[model samples]
Target: MVSVALAKPLDPCESPAPFSLLVPVYRGDSAHRVRRAIDSNTHEQTRPPAQVVIVRDGPVPQEITDELDRISAASAVPVVRVELEHNAGLTNALNTGLLWCSHDVVARADADDISYPDRFERQLPLIEAGADLVGASMHEIGDDETTPLALRQAPVGRSEIARVAKRRNPISHPSVVFRRSAVEAVGGYEHVPMAEDYWLWARMLHAGADVRNVSEPLVGYRVSAGSYERRGGPRVFLAEMALQWKLRRLGYVGFIQWATNVIVRGGYRFVPLKARETAYRFMVGHRNS
Candidate 1:
C-alpha cells in the first residue's frame, strides 16, 4: 500500500502564511502616502507579509526615494527592490515586480491606498483553501483619507466571480492576494492601460482559476477629485474600448456584451467630471461622510 501525507491544518495562533507584499511606485505617487502604505501592509497587519517587493516604475523625486529607503530599512520583513530607468506604466511595472516576489503568494498594495490591519489575516486562509486569487471589498476614502466616500464591493464565490468577469472586473486589485504561479501562467498582467487588472481577471477566469472575494472591506482606496477625473477623458475612453475589444476577441464575451460594455462603460468616460463622480458614488453606494 502506498501512503501519502495530507497537509497539516493551519493554526490561527501561529505566524502568518508566507507571502510577499507587492507595491509599485511611480513619479506621481505621494511620498507620505507611500510610507503609510508600507507601514500598514507590514507593521500594522495582524498577519504581516514575510517579504516585500517594491518596483520603482521610473524616476521619482528624491523625497519619495528617501522615504522609501527609510521605511524599508525599518520594515520587519526583507525588502526586494527593482528600479526601471524609464516609466513603463502600471501594467509593465506590476509584471516586473511579480517576477521578484520571494513567496508563492503575493498581496498587492497601491501606494495611495491603505490596507487594514486584518487584511492579510482575512485573505490568507482562503488561499490555503485552494483559491488561486482572493480579493476583498474596499472602502473608498476621500482626500482626507479618513472620511469614507463609498464602498467598492466585489463578487464573492467562484461562480459569481466568473460570471461578473464576463461583464466587469470582479476583483478589487489593491485588496487582492493571489498565487504567483496562477497569474504567471496566464502571462502576468497583460497591458491594457487603465484596465490591466480587469484584463488579468478575465484571462484567469477563462483559464479556470479558482477566484474568490471576501465580503468584508479590507482596504481603504484613496479617491481624490483628480482620481475621479482620470476615470473619464479621451485616453481613458480609448483604453476602455480596447479592453472591451480584447475581451470579445478572447471569447470571454459575445458581440452583444461587448457592444453593451462600450455603450455603458465607454460612454461613462465621456461624461463631465462632476457628473462622473456623482454617478460613480451612486453606483458604489456612497457614504455620507
Candidate 2:
C-alpha cells in the first residue's frame, strides 16, 4: 500500500494563498512522465504551484511509490500523496484531491501531458479576470515526442465560449485552471465515465459559471490511435450524440449535429474515415471563409 497524507486544514486569512494542482495516477503510468510533470512545476519560470496533490489509486508498485517519494523530496513545492485501497476511477481520485486542496485556485494535469513553461503564468491572469474557468490551446505531439501534428485552440471570452461550447467541448481538461469555488458550486466532478470533462463543463455552465479559453498553446497533448479508439469509438460517438440531443433541448446545437448530418448525407458506407476527412475539410473551409 502507498503512504497517504491529508493536507492540514487552513483558515481563511492565510497569506500568499497557494494553488492546488490535482494529479490522479493509475497503474501502467510511466514514472519518468510523472517525474517530468513534477519537475515542470518546480522549474516553472512564472508563479509555481503551491502544492501538488497526487492521488495514487489502488496499490501501485513499490518502484513507482519510491520514485514519487524521491521526486517529492527534491521538489521545491509541497507534494502530497493520497492512497486508495482500491481503484475507484478518475472521478473518485480527483474528488480526493479536491478534499485535500486548501487553495483558492485549482489546476489540473494529466500524467501524459506536458505543460509549457509559461502555462501557469499565462493562466493566472485569466483566473483573476473573474472567469470561473480558463483553458489554453494544446499542441498535439506524436509518439516520437518530436513531431507536432495539430494545434487545438478553444474559444475565449464568456459569450464566445458559450457559443462554441454549445457546438462542442471547447476546452481541454488537462490544460484548464479555474476557481475552487466555481467547481464546488457545480457539485465538483461527476461520474461520467469516458466523458467526465464534458459532463463537468456542462454542469458548471448550467450553474452559471463563466468559462474562457486562452488563445495560446500552453501544453502538449499526446494523441495516439490506441488512446483515441479506447475512448469508445462508435459507442462514444453515439453517446456524445445523445448528450448533444439533450443539449439541443436546452437550446444548444452541438458539433455532433453537424457531424451526424454529414454521416447521414454521405451514407454509412463512407461514414468511417473518408467521410470524417471530408467533413473536416468542409468545416475548415467554412471557418476560413
RMSD in angstroms, all models? 4.4, 7.1
Q: What does the lDDT come to for candidate 2?
A: 0.70
RMSD of 1: 4.4
What TM-score quantifies how close candidate 2 is to the native fold? 0.80
Q: What is the lDDT of residue 124 in candidate 1?
A: 91
Q: What's the true lDDT of residue 103 in model 2?
A: 86
Give per-residue CA lDDT, model 2, range 1-289, as digits (tens). 1111222333446543468888887786778777776666556637778888889988877777888889778877888889899999898988888888878788898877788889988887666656678898877776554556676766777787776665456678989987777777767787764657877787677657777788877877776665433433556556555655555554445467655633543243235565554454343222211
Candidate 1 regions with alpha-carbon error over 4 angstroms: 1-16, 282-289
Please, what are the lDDT tens digits per residue for candidate 1 over residues 1-289? 1111222445668765699999999999999999989988998999999999999999999999999899778877999989999998998889899889988889999998999999999999988867788999999885666777678877787777777787677888899999888888777888888888989888887777778899988999987657888899889999989999898888889998889889988889989888898877665545554
Evaluate residue 153 in candidate 1 and report its C-alpha lDDT on the 0 to 100 scale: 75
Model 2 lDDT, residue 55, Cα? 90
Q: lDDT of each prediction vs. the true structure?
A: 0.85, 0.70
After TM-score superposition, the amount by which residue 34's alpha carbon in candidate 2 deviates from its true location, in angstroms, is 1.3
